[model samples]
Target: MAMLNQVSSQDVETLYFNHHGWLLGWLRRKLDNSFDAADLAHDTFVRVLRKRELEALREPRAYLCAIARDLAVSHWRRQALEQAWLETLATLPEPIVPSLEQRALILETLEQIALILDALPMRVRQIFLLSQIDGLTYPQIAAQLGVSINVVQKAMVRALMQCYKVLYRGG
Candidate 1:
């Protein structure tokens, strides 16, 4: 279908000219911050450009809105995660608190892990988190979740394989 076909640079240029203002305003209303709204609007267009498929888009505004919505959700999720991390840091003694650079590195790593966890299947993710984050054994997880040990083991394997693919295999 033409909708799935590659879009040309000129088509993207036309799209930007046609809808940029509307998107910016829509983002502003959703984000309540002009700067972030502007940034996300630009990012939404960039994402669309990367997809490179818009020639047969029946509803460009709807398509843009969907992309922008996803971006906004991610933006909010990141902000919430940062706030939670900062709160955790605040609970630490000053001497034990990490340096700014170390905190940045830690936060980045945490975000990556969070993304991987988010991508995992629900049951697999629960098992993986129980084992890794809560320090539970497979048997313990199985007991807690009312599942078989074999089930827990298999879920753990799937979760680990997914993480390996995302981190090491760069999938």
Candidate 2:
């Protein structure tokens, strides 16, 4: 067990030292921004270090590349969502006015919440969103959906589970 642990620790350290520059270069090629690439490279190493077992990795380079790719995709998706949200907010009426910074912050929070909601089942997502965002009480939501209060509670629990999965699993 000691030998295995030492080998794994050495392997991870060597992997990081040998490939850190290459990983940053790869990210730069994909992202076209040195600062963003650096940030992604740092995040990738953080993720690898947090994993439980590095010795079991058959292809460390491939795993790290996948992590970087996922991060890049998430960054792109967030940017797209933010742009769309800004455009939507720009057209809103004066009654719901929000400042530019507030609009950005709200969009970011909404994006995160929406990602959590996306993991939920359709009905559960709708029910939870109605309760939290629409200000509908459990009993009111139950009545509107023609379900019992118990059913509404179960749906809320299910929705919360999905949110936890997304947040904790980093999905």
Could you give me the TM-score of model 2 versus the true structure?
Answer: 0.59
**Using TM-score as the measure, which candidate wins?**
1
Model 1 has an lDDT value of 0.90
Model 2, 8-121: lDDT tens per residue? Answer: 556668888988999999999999999999999999988777776555566667878999998888778788888888788779898897887897788778778867876688
Best prediction by lDDT: 1
* Candidate 1 ranges with C-alpha deviation above 4 Å: 1-3, 52-55
Compute each candidate's TM-score over C-alphas: 0.90, 0.59
Give the CA lDDT, 0 to 100, for residue 138 in model 2: 97
Model 2 per-residue lDDT at 31: 97
If candidate 2 were superposed on the true structure by all CA atoms, what would the RMSD be? Answer: 5.8
Residue 73 error for model 1, in Å? Answer: 1.8
List clash counts for every candidate, in order. Answer: 0, 0
Cα-based lDDT for every prediction? 0.90, 0.83
